[model samples]
Each structure stands twice: as structure tokens, then as C-alpha cells.
Target: MSAAPFTVLIPARLASTRLPGKPLADIAGLPMVVRVARQAAQSAATQVVVAADDARIVQACAAHGVTALLTRTDHASGSDRLAQACDLLALPDEAIVVNVQGDEPLVAPALIDAVAALLRARPEASMGTAAHAIDSWQDFISPHVVKVVLDAQGLAHYFSRAPIPHARDQAEGQAWWQQAPLQRLAPLRHIGLYSYRAGFLRRFPQLAAAPTEQLEQLEQLRALWHGHAIAVHVTQQAPAAGVDTPQDLERVRALLGHG
Candidate 1:
């Protein structure tokens, strides 16, 4: 399938409680955000731009020859920063904008293409994201691993940290997904990458937080609560881990042959 042309927006913040200046953190000698931008650039996206919370981030991107724009530091979330960026870039309402988190330097280009294509394929969906079938019982029950339940049309029914579609039968450590009735229907692990129409991207900040969102600590629920459909593209492979702490950075650096 041909990947529809889209723009990639990476929201980067300098102040990280876990790793200060994370976006500017070095991995294999390049800033982590710069590495993420480079990976996103490999996709079918027409342009890859960083919506940075600080001028230092902009300067870092410029130094590395990457396009970046400075956004308000006070923005409540990364999505808000991207909303302002959509206006600053003058993106058309119908244009596709994929949100690639700044910390995912090892993100796959194919995943980005798959997500952007969803907007073109499913006009009914207001947004697009990827997920993969859960293969481990441990991950299925882990709160850190988000789970998504999809409808017949592949639209998201709900996203939660709980072990959803709970197997009332699978006790102890049995293979719940391998049960005869669920052989082809395993639970899914939601990937964080998201693609949104530029119009919706800009309006996202105005949506009231959903109760589920606050309880689960997931912002995507706000869109679902406000009656927006998020199409889910099921990928076979799980996504790489995103950096949130110094240990994660070290792991990534080691993987990149710099540690």
C-alpha cells in the first residue's frame, strides 16, 4: 500500500524530571531528539519538524541541520505543543500529522508510514495509532504496558493499563490467548505513536479530560471521551522502548554502539 504524504511533528521538552535536557541528551554523539528526527525523516512523511518547548532545543536541532520551531514552554502537554505547531506551520485541516515522541530514537520508519496511511484509508477515523498482539501474559497484566481493545471496524473501543478483555478462565500462568475460543483474537498492546488530522491536532487542547483519562493517566482517552474515533493499525512487531530515565538512555546508547 502506498503511504499517503504526511508531516511528522515531534514535541520536545528540555526539562525532564528523570533526565534533565533529555531531548538534548547525547546518544552515539548525536542529541536524542536529533536521532529521533532522523529516524522519522526516513518515513514517507513530506517533512519532519520538531515542536520544541525551549529555544535551546531549537538551537540544538539547527546545529544538527534539522528543522525545528520554538513553542510555548508552559503548554500543558506535548500534544498542546504540537497544536501550536500546526498553526505555526499553517497546516491544512485535512493534512495528516503524525506525532512521534521525541524520546523514541529507535522508532521504525515503517510504523510511521503505516500510521499515516490510516488517515487516508479510514476517513471515518479522526486519528490513527498502532498496536500489536500481546504475546506475554506478564505484559498483558503490567500497568506500564497499555492495552487497547478494538471494534469490528478496527476503531478503538478503549485503552487502559488494566488487563482488559480479562480472561476469567486463565488463572495462574496459563496461555489465555491460546484458548480455543481466543486463538485468533489475542489482547493487544497499544503503541504510543499517533497520527492526527491537522484540524483535530489543533483542537485537541480544548477537549475536556475524560474520567478514564485521569484514572488511567492516558491523554488519548480524552479524544475518545469527546466522541472522536481513533483508528488502530495492528502491527505484528512490538515497538522499541522509549527513553524515560538514565538507565534507558544507557541501554539505547549501548544498542547504538556508543556505550
Candidate 2:
């Protein structure tokens, strides 16, 4: 099969609990959504569009010459927003859509291409995501850092907030520990980036939530529960984290020479 055309969609919700108006938050005098759209444009995607929930986000992207489409505020997840975006853009079911989070202003173009390419290479897969080796022990144990285990074919076997593929031998009584600080483990840190075949993305919202999804608060688990293969592109380097809180915003600003 020939390579399917792809588009990048950044979901921007204004009413973030951690940081309100997060999509429009400024970093180096540019709206965060605009920054993410600009980064996505550098990728192999044919187009980059911001699927925003607010008009301000649309205007913010408009000012930067980024395409922004206002989507329903009631959509529970980014994938849902992107589904609506696919409808608005009239994308065919075979079209590929990469969900690049709006807060990820520093998301790498290569990572975006990697995920899309992974989906393209795996015709059996309905979705594709990226992962990287876990270097820090703190990240390995932190519930905030989502972990993934891949099958021999590079398909995601599972995703969880808890450390997966538990190192039983390295257990410190009840807690797991990496004895050697310098040793980089095989367990992968799941990046939030996702690429989907448009038909599956449109059907994602309808996929019933599984027990694992509710327990882990991870929507991706629903895809696995529904028996859809998610190809995971293991990357050489970890992508930059997205802004989720006030401290994250400040850190991004500092990185952009603003703070």
C-alpha cells in the first residue's frame, strides 16, 4: 500500500483545571497552541490544524497563520476533538491524523513523523504512538509518568501509571527499586503523541471504557481493550514534556528565554 496522507491535529481546551486557558497561554509572546501548530508544520504532515474549544484559541492561531477549528467543548478527550476535526476537514477514513497535544509547544517534528510512519508501516495497527527508554529511577516509579510495554512486534501490550514489567528481583521489600542509578532499563516511557487512521479515530469515542482505563485514567487502554493494535515507535530520545501546571508553564517560558 502507498503511504497515506497525514494531518496533524492539536487539541486545545481552554478550561484546564491545572492551568485555565492553557491553549492560549503565552510562551515567548506566542500562544502555546500556535507554538505547537508551528512545530507540527515542520513535520511530514500535509497540514497542521488546531482543534480548539474556544474562540480565543482560534484567534490566537489565526494571528500566527495556523489553522484552528472550533470544536465541541463537551468532548471528553483530545481524540474526540480530533474526530470532529476530521469531520470538519472532510478527511477520508484512510487519512492519517496525528494527535499532537496543544500544550506540547516543544514537540519534535521527527517524533510526529515517527508515529505517523509507524502507523503507515503497520497496516494491522489502528493507532501508533512513541516511547523511549527510562533513564531516571524517579520517572520509572512516578505515577505521573505513564509506562508502556511493547510486544515483540513493537505493538503496545499495556500502558499504566504504575511501573510495568515490574523488576521483581529489584524489589525493595514492597517497593520496586533500580539498584544501579546509571543503568537505563528496558521499560519504556510512553509519549502522549498519537497517530490514528481516521475511521478508528472517529470511532474512538464510542469504544466502551474498560476497567483498566477507569483505574489508570488512561483513555488509550480503551483501544487495547477493544482489541485494536497500537504500534509503538521506540525513539532514541525522549520528547520534551508538555505544560500541564503553573510550574510547567514557567519552565517552558524559561526554556524559551522568557522567564
Candidate 3:
């Protein structure tokens, strides 16, 4: 599907606690951030700009002929950085912007397009994101895998670390998603990709953190708490994970033939 006219914003920071200078970490012959930008460029987005926290990150993008903006280093989150970026670029309130993680070098261009398109099609939604149905019992029950339950209209009801739509009658430690009532209301694993309007993106950080958001440690709940709708697109399969540690970086490198 074709996406509306859109821009991609990639927020990169140098202060990763697990892997310092993470944006500049070498993946193949290019900086990890640059690889992410190149992948986003392949999408329907008219532009792919890095909203970088450090000048070195800005320079790296410039050297690779990618557009980038130097955002505040003290911003609390990626959303905050993106809000500043929207202002820096002078994007209109109605402009759609996709937030692509700088660490997700293997992020799919088609997936990026799908998210932006989803937002454009759902006017009632302030945000758009993707999820994939969970097939494995381990992933279904794992705290590391975020679960999203959708309403009938394909809007997210809630996102959580715990297994949702709980099958009280079913035995524990089994694949609930593959059986009876659970199969009808299958559990979905949320993807990190997001698409937001420039206006909403700018206003997001100002919204008070929700009690549920604080407990789950999920930022998207803030929007839900404030009565903002989030439309979700369910994909058939999950995308590759983002780099958080040395081990994850090595895994991605091997997948990309860089190891």
C-alpha cells in the first residue's frame, strides 16, 4: 500500500548505557545509524532525517549524504527528540512522520511504509503501529515480548509485558494462542515502529505519564491515558530486533553477512 507524503525521523543518542556510542557502532563498513537511514530511505517517505543528540552523529549522517538535525542532548526520550525535530524541520501539524530507531538497521522499508499509510487511513488515530501474532508459547509468556490487544476496529486496547486476554480455563505453560477461545482472540506482539502526526508528536512528551505506563514501563500508554487513539496494523511475521547489547549487535551483523 502507498503511504501518504511523509518524512522519517530517526532519533539517535551517543549515551547508550549498554553500548556506548551506539549510533556510530560499526555494522559492516557503515555506522549503524547510517545503515538505518539508508533502509528508511527505501520506504515511501520523501525524506529520512536523523534526529541526533550528538554532533558526531550529525556529522556521520552528513558525511554519508543523509539529512540530519542536532536535537537537544537532555531530552528524556526518543519522542521528545522527535518533537524537537518536527519543529526544527518546520513540518506542518498534519504532516505524518515515522519514527525509525537508529539501532534497527535491518528494519524493513515496506514495514515503514505500512505504518505511515495506516496513520493516514485512520483519521481518528493519533498514532499507528504494527504487531505480529505470537505463535510460540515462550514468546507469548515472555516479559521481554510486549503484547498488544486490539479492539474490533483494529485499535489497540492496551499494550503489556504480560500475556493478555488471559485464558483462565486453560492450563498454564501451554500455547494458549493456538487453542479454542484464545485462538479467536489471538495474542499479538507489538513492534517498536510508530507513525505520528507532527502535531501529536510535538505534544506527546507534554502529556502526563499514565499510572499504567509507569507500571508497565511503556511510553505509548501515556497517549492512551490521555484519550488518544492508536491504530494498529497486524503483520504476518515479526521484524528483526534492535541492537541493545553486544550480543544483539553480533547477531544482526551475522544476519547481514558482516560477521
Candidate 4:
């Protein structure tokens, strides 16, 4: 069979708590949402669509000549909004659907391809995501940085705010710990990007919210609770910063060398 066509769907909501109307926030002259869609379009996916709950977001996408779908604002997560968008578009069950976060204006096209390709190769995987090795204790311990433990087959075992595979020997100051490969033993930071089969995407909202998911505020946990394997694609480079506040926007602007 031929490779299935993949579609990139960006879930954009205007009422952001950190930065209100964030999708319309100007980034190097263009709105942040538009930049995200443009970056996602560069991926190997067949098409890109912005799933917006507000009319302004739809207008912003239209100004850039990108496809935009109007979804309900009542959806709690971006994944839910994405499923509604897929329904609006009438996508087939076998189609690959990539959920590209709208705040990530600098998201890498290669990373997008990596997640989408992983799902394409693993037909049994219900979902696919990316992760990178955590090099420092700061990132490893930071609750803001979600960490993931993967199984031997590169499938996610667990995702947590706390570090996993604790460095017990390091804490004990064992001589063997000093010689062990500490760098390689660090936990992986889970990237927010994800891809799923259209059929799975539609079924996601119907799945009961897992208790662990509610406690951790991580929706992916629900999949693990449902006994669905999520294949993880480890990447060498780190993903771009998602703009959630003024400081994050400033950092992105500096990276882009905007006036």
C-alpha cells in the first residue's frame, strides 16, 4: 500500500490566560498562529489546517490563505478541538492527523516529519510523539518540563512532572555511580507535538478521562490508561519554545532577530 496522506491541524484559541488573544499576537510582522501553520505546511504532510474557536483566528488564517476550520470553544484541550476539525473536514479513518500546537511559532519542520513518519511506520501505534534527552538537572527536575519514560521498543511507559529512573546511586555517592553513564541515563523531555490516526483521533474525546491524567494535567496519560501504545520518536535537537507569556514571545523574537 502507498503512504497515507498526513494533515497538520493547529488548534488555536484566542482566550489565553497568560497572553490573551495569543494567536493574533504579532511575531516578526505575522501573527503567531499564521507562522505556526506556515511552518507545519513545510512538513511532508499533504495539507495544513488551523482549527480555531474564534472568528478572529479564522480571519488571521484566511489572511494568510491557509485552510481554517471553526471549532467549538467548549473543548477543553487542543486534541479535542483537532478532532472536531477532522470531523468538519470529513477525514477518513486511515488518514494521518498531526496536532501542531499553535503557540509554537518556531516549530521545526523536521520534528513534524519525525512524529508523522513514526506513526506511518507503526501501524499498531494509536498515537506518536517526540522526546529529547534531558541534559541538565534543572530541566530534569523542573515540573514545567514534562519527562517521559519509554519502554524497550521506544513506546512511552510513563510521563511525569518528576524525573524517572531516579539516580539512587548518585544520591548515595556510590563509586560505581561516578563511573556510570549519567548523561545517557537522564530522563527524556516529552515534546508537545503529536500525530494520530484519524480514527483514533475521533475516539479520543469519548475515552473517559484517567484519574492520573486529571492529577497530572497531561492528556496523553489517558491513552496509557486505556492500554494504547504511544510510540516515541527520539530526536537529537530540542523543540522550539511555545510562546505562553510576554517573556517567551520576547525570546522567540530575539531568536528570530526581529526589530
Candidate 5:
């Protein structure tokens, strides 16, 4: 099969609960949204565009010569915003579309390529995402960290905030639960980045929210609940932190300066 061109869409919105006007927030002298777009441009994607709702965000992208499309402000999720972007860009059904989060200025180019390539290689998959091994018990228990259970084929079985393959015997202080044998079965931490075929991208908003999705507040669960297969590409490296709060922004700034 011929390689299909991929478009990376950075969905940015000014209104953020943790950090208001986050898209325009300055990080190392540049708006956070523009920084993400710049990093995404390093990928082999055919094009990179900022799908935003605010006029200021549109202006910022224009100033940097980055393509920006104004999407509706009512979109409940970034995936929905990306769908509008696909329509505005006139991407075909066979084209690949990546939804790069605007808040993730530290997103790695290689990770973006991995997700896009996964979808390209698996034509039958409606979506593709990345995951890293869970090394620490702290991360495994953190509700903020989403966990994914993958099948033998590397496709996600489920995603949740709670730990899976629950150690029912751990409550009894079983010595075996802390052994290497049990540690070898550690769960994978789900990364938020995602890529999808234009065909599925266009249909995402139409899918009803699944019960698990609503309970966990995870959008990808809706796809799994609907029986759509999501290929999970495991990577050895840890993904960079997404700037969701002031503290996260400070850490990213420090990393960029030190680099």
C-alpha cells in the first residue's frame, strides 16, 4: 500500500480550568500553542495546523506563519475540534490525521511519528496511540495517570484511572505480589497523544459516549466500547509532561532552558 500523507492538528483553546487562557500563555518567550505546533512540524507529517477557537490563537499562528483554522468554541473535546479542522483542510478519507495536544509543548517528534506510523501500517485500525511501561508503584496508583490493558496483538483492551488486573490477593499482604514474577506483569501507562484515519476522524463526534468513558472521563473509552480497535504502540522512553498547570509550565521551562 502507498504511504498516505498525514496532517498533524494541534487543538488549542484559550479557556482552561487549570490555567485560564493557557494557549496564549508564554513559555520560554513563545505562546504554548505555537511551541507545540513548532515541535509537531519537526515530524514527517505532510502539514501542521493549529485548530483553535480563539481569535488570538489564530493571530498567533499567523504571526509565526503556521496554518491555523478557527473551529467552533462549543467542542467538548480536542478530537471534536480536530474533526472540524479536517473538514476545513479538505483532507480525504484515506488521509491520516494526528491530534497533537496544544498543552503538550514537550511532545516528542519521534512519538508523534510512532502513532502516525502505527495507523499507516494498520489500515484496519480506526485509531493508534502510545504507551510506556509502568516502573513505579506510585505511578501505577496515581489516579491522574491513566492505565491501559493491551491484548497480545498490542491493541488496547481497556483504559482507566484505576489499576487493572487488580491484585485481589495483595490486600492479604501476599509476598508474591511484590516479587519479580508479578512485577513482570506490570500495566502500561497510557499516553494522551493519538492519531486516526480521516474516515474515523470524521465519524468520532457521532459516536455516543460509553458508560465507562463517562464514568472515567476518558474519550478513547467510547471507541473501545463501540468495538473499534485501537492499536497500542509501546515505547521505552517516557513521554514529556503536558502543561496543564502553572507547576507543569515551570518544569517545562526549566527543561527547555537546561537543554
Candidate 6:
């Protein structure tokens, strides 16, 4: 498949449940959103913009020399913010847009490029995202860690908070983790990063939220409900976990050193 030009949009929301004002939270002296933008700038994206929901976030971006645009405060999801960003920028239908979360300051640039390339390779897919095998039982059982089951063609069959592809035979004890090894059909922890065609992104919100989407709180389900195929790019490299709480923020700060 031919390479296509792609843009990275980082969605920044100020009101995070675990860490309020998260986008503006300082990480190595720069705001969190700015740090994320800087990481994305290292990617192959033609342009990297922060789809900020607050003026403070935009201001922080400006101070850091990162492009940012103020978006509506009520966007239901990062995908929605990305759609608005796409409209504001007047991106063409064929343009690829990658939604990188503002909290992922440690995200790898290669993963960003890989997801975009995945979408480009599969013209039938409306969007693409990455996933890696679950290595720990805690991650596999944790409701906060969303899991995805993929089909033979690498298209996601379902995404859920529950432990899936149950090793029924090994349910009795600590053997399930060992028995349920990472195979082609084994469960994978879904990485939140996403790549979407500009056209599909614009129409994503129009697809009514599915029952499963609401139950699992996973927006990707809406796409599947609408019969849209989302390509799953399975990567062996596990990405650094994104910051979502005060402890997470401190961990990230420690990793980067306080500034």
C-alpha cells in the first residue's frame, strides 16, 4: 500500500475525573498537552495540532510553540473533538487523522505512524487502532483496561471491559494466565490511539451510540454497530501507559524529572 499524508490531533480536556486540569498539569516544566504535542511532532504527521477544549490549554500550547485550536467544551469524546478540528482545518475526505490523547506524553512516534499506515493499507476499514497482548493477569482482569478480540483478518470482533476469550478449562485457579497464552485469537489490551479517515470521522458522531457502546463505555462499538470495520494493528511492543490519575501524574513527573 502507498503511504498517505496524515495529521495528528491531540484532544485535551481540562476536567479529568482523576486529575482535574490535566491538560495544563505540568510535566517537566511544560504543560501535559504540550508534552504530548511535542511527542506527536516527532511522528511522520504532516501537522500536529492540539484540539483543546479550554483556552488555558491553547495558551499553554502557544507558549510551547505547539499549534492548538480551541474547540467546543461539550464534545462527548476525543473523536468528536477531532471531527471539529478536521472541519476547522478543512481537511480533505481522504486525509488521515490520528487522535492522540493529551495524557500520552510517552507515546511512541512509530505507533502513531503504524496506525495511520494500517488505515491506508485497508481501504475497506473506516478507522484503525493498535493493541498488544495482555501479559499480566491484573491487566487482563482490570475493568479499566479495555480488551479487544480480533477476527482472522485483524478486524476487531468486539471490545469489552470484561475478561474475554475465557479459558473455561483453566477457570479454577492461577493456571488460566499460563494456559491462555498470546495466540492469534488471544485477548489484547486495546491501546486508545486511533487513526480515522477525515470523511469517516466527520460522520462518526452521526452513528447513534450502540447499546454495547453505552454499556462498555467504548465508542468504537458505535462504528461496529454501523457496520464499519476498524482495523486492529497488533504490535508486540507495549506502549507506556497514559496518565489518568494523581499517582499517574506523579509517576510521569518522576520519569521526566520535575521542572
- Pairing residues by index, what is the TM-score of model 2? 0.93
lDDT of 6 by residue, 1-259 (tens): 5468899999899998888999999888989898899999998999999999889889889988999999999998888899999999999988999999999999999999999998878999999999998877777888999999888888989999998867776653342555435354556999999999999999998789999999989999999988999999988899998999999999999999985
- Per-residue lDDT tens digits for candidate 5, residues 1-259, read 6445788999999998999999988888888898999999998888999999989999998998889999999998889999989899888888888889999998899899889999877777899999998776777777999999988788999999987657876753243335787866677899998999887988989999899999999999999999899998899999988988989888888887733
- List TM-scores for all candidates, in order: 0.97, 0.93, 0.97, 0.94, 0.94, 0.96
Where model 5 places Cα greater than 4 Å from the true spot, the runs are 1-4, 171-178
RMSD (Å) per prediction: 1.2, 2.6, 1.2, 2.2, 2.2, 1.6
Query: Which sections of candidate 3 miss by over 4 Å?
Result: none
Q: Give lDDT: candidate 1, residue 68.
A: 100
Task: Select the stronger candidate by lDDT from 1 and 5.
Answer: 1
- Which is the better candidate, 2 or 3, if ranked by lDDT? 3
lDDT of 3: 0.93
CA shift at 79, candidate 4, in angstroms? 1.1
lDDT string for model 3 (66-163, tens) is 99999998999999999999999999999999999999999999999999998778999999999998888889889999999999899999999999
lDDT of 1 by residue, 54-106 (tens): 88999999999999999998999999999999999999999999999999999
How high is the CA lDDT of each candidate model?
A: 0.94, 0.89, 0.93, 0.88, 0.88, 0.90
- Candidate 5 residue pairs that clash: none
> Which ranges in model 6 have alpha carbons more than 4 Å from their true place?
173-177, 180-182
Show the lowest summed lDDT stretch of 10 residues, model 5.
169-178
Query: lDDT per residue, candidate 4, 1-259, as tens digits?
Result: 5545799999999998999989998888889999999999888889999999999899888998988989998998888899899899999998899899999999999899889988878877999999998777677778999999988888999999976767764653232222457655557999999999999999999999999999999999999999999999999997777998999998988887767
Q: For every model in order, what is the number of clashing pairs?
A: 0, 0, 0, 0, 0, 0
In Å, residue 17's CA in model 3 sits off its true spot by 1.3
- Candidate 4 residue runs with Cα over 4 Å from true position: 1-3, 172-179, 182-184
Give the better candidate number (1 or 2) by TM-score.
1
